[model samples]
Target chain A: MIVLVDYKAGNLTSVQLALAEVGHESVISSDPSVISAADRLVFPGVGAAGSAMEEVNRLGLAPVLKDFVATGKPFLGICVGCQIILDWSLEDGRTACLGLIPGGTEIFTPGPGSKVPHMGWNHVGFYRPHPLFEGIPDRSHFYYVHSYYPTPSDHADVLAESDYAGVRFAAILGRKNLAAVQFHVEKSGAHGLRLLKNFCAWDGGC
Target chain B: MLTKRVIVCLDVRNGKVTKGVKFAGNVDLGDPVEMGAQYYRDGVDELVFYDIMASAEKRPIDIAMVRAVARKVFIPFSVGGGIRNLEDMREVLLAGAEKVSVNSLAVQNPDIISQGARAFGKQCIVLGMDAKRSDAPGLPSGYEVYVQGGRKAMGIDAVDWARRAVSLGAGEICVNSIDADGTKSGYELKLTRLIADAVEVPVIASGGAGTPAHLVDVFREGRADAGLVASMVHYGTYSLPSIKSALATAGIPVRSVP
Candidate 1:
């Protein structure tokens, strides 16, 4: 069964329901054994990086997440859950993250006539071929609700890119057994559901 | 680039959608689940269900409807009305709604905004303000905040309240004009622009959405990030795709319909 890590972060329900829609039965858990034993891990989060990190550490699931990644298990993170895997985040005035990705996250300081939070649907341009994007079109629009985005040190880690306020950021990222998206795939429509189904069948070999 | 959002608002009273909403396949209408699924399939960026039931028993029925919609529809949708505190917000979100909007209760207790934002993150808290044109003393924008579903006017400046709500961590602001609600003549551009300019958060222009041209005006002139509609789509006056196509033709960036 797919194990969805529970760290008291939001969007767990939507993620679970989306998985169900894709014909997958997943269990939400913070238990170490359940998370580590599962074939795949779906880490979904919303809210500030500081508190989200605190919850991960509080539940003692941080180390478990690290070990799961190290084992080359299929894993995915969404939204802030995706951000927390980065080295650091500028949200809440700089919060330390899981450091799985070698870079940090920065808040969007858009030019004039740009709204912060970077909320709404925007196009995602694929940079590299991956199974996660099996049938999805290039530059397809997905729902986004975030003020900060990850700045991966290695450009090769970037799977897809999206522009906001003239600044193009990494909308989808992948490294070995892990894939994470800055957009809320659960909230996104058909394309999102397709992406989730692809991930469900992913074997951690990008 | 964040394209402008076209949202369909549904008013649910006692498990029944109170407005005109036709299902494409079925002849019968007013089913919230069918209408919501139809709108989502028609390319609406988002959906909002406002709980207007006054009875306690009907509240659970609304929650059930939210669950049903979440099961079939795969887009983001928000729930509002009768949400008094964080628990209520949690109930709606847990029931599968993405955001919980607070209007009259927010005006009564301002802390709920900050509290909800703190608990569920700012993205989940939406400030729904019903504003009316006012030239009363001390009213700067000539728009006063209205509460109790537009029955009572609080002398509070509309723009100021929006700013405060954002500062208190409101992720989005929905400015509904009491005067233009059902008139469909046009949106209250003045009020929409005032609040849209005041807050950095995304602002939705609601109340009067007569034609696709009105949405174009709000997106360009009013600077609204999103436009909310009910009567036009509900009454079958405009299909969701046609409205989006109109916005795109007018040179305004909008999500392409499916």
Candidate 2:
């Protein structure tokens, strides 16, 4: 069973509903054992990083998630879930993160005619062939609604990039067993569902 | 590149899809969930469901209805109407809506905007404004904010309201023209442009979309980031694909339907 980590950040229902659409059975759990034992873990959150991390530590999920990531199982992080996996976030006054991936999240600066939060459907360009994007076309539109984007300490870990207002940032990051997206795959329509399906079938080998 | 969003608005009342002219002359369209699913399949970028009677009736939004629609729509969908506080916003977001839009309640309590944004991310909070044409000297843009389904005017400038809403952490703004609603003449381009230019957040233009040209005009002239439609899509006048195709031809960036 796929375990959906729920620390009560936000929008866990949408992710659960999206998984159901792909015919996957996911258990939303805060239990460490359930999460660590699951074949795959999907950490999805929406909200401030500081509070999300607080909940993670309060529930002792930070260690649980770290242990799960070390198991070499298929894992996915989305939005704030994706950001919290990084080293730190500039949101909520520079909160420290899980450090699962070598990266830091920074807020998007408003450029000429470019809105903050970058809320809209933007194209995702693939950097390397990965199973998570097996069917999703390069430059396919995905819904994004976050001001912060993760910048990997090592550029090679970047799996995909999206350009908004001439600022190109990491949209998808994958390293071995861990995969994370800065956008909401649950709300990205067909392409997102297809990506979720691919993740369901991913063996965490590549 | 980010594509311009085309949203399908379903003005639902008592759990049924309803449409009215300028917020009156009510008519039931069909099942909201089924219609939303069909629109999702037709390649609409987003969906908005506003509970028409929630605010006026002093009732909270219908969670079951929002759940029903969110179940079928895989794309992003927003729920509006009667969201008075962060708890109400939480209920709707937990019901599976990607965003919560505040209209009359937002005007009554602007703090809900910042609270909702802080509780949930700014992206999850949407500011929904209803505006009517006005020529007051204080309102140079000639628009005033309306509330309670356009039955009451708040005497606030539409442009100023939008800017303040964004400052309060609203990620996007949906502006509906009270005078242009249901007329199908076209969107209030002047008013929409004024509000769009006033805020950096993405602005969605609502009301008065008779044909594809209206959408083209809104995006090209009004500079709206998105367009919201009800009658055209509700009555099967134009499918989402047809409108998107027209937009693509008009040089507006839109997602290609498979």
Best by DockQ: 2
Cα RMSD of all models vs. native, in order, equals 3.1, 1.3
DockQ in order: 0.76, 0.80
Which residue ranges in model 2 land beyond 4 Å of their true spot?
Answer: none
Worst 10 residues of 2 chain B by lDDT: B133-142
DockQ of 1: 0.76
lDDT of 2 by residue, B147-234 (tens): 8889898889898899999999888999999999999999999988888878888899999998989999998889899999989988
- Cα TM-score per model: 0.96, 0.97
DockQ, prediction 2: 0.80
Query: In order of the candidates, what TM-score does chain B achieve?
Result: 0.93, 0.98
Candidate 1, superposed: residue stretches over 4 Å from native = B20-29, B55-61
lDDT at residue A182 of model 2 (Cα atoms): 92
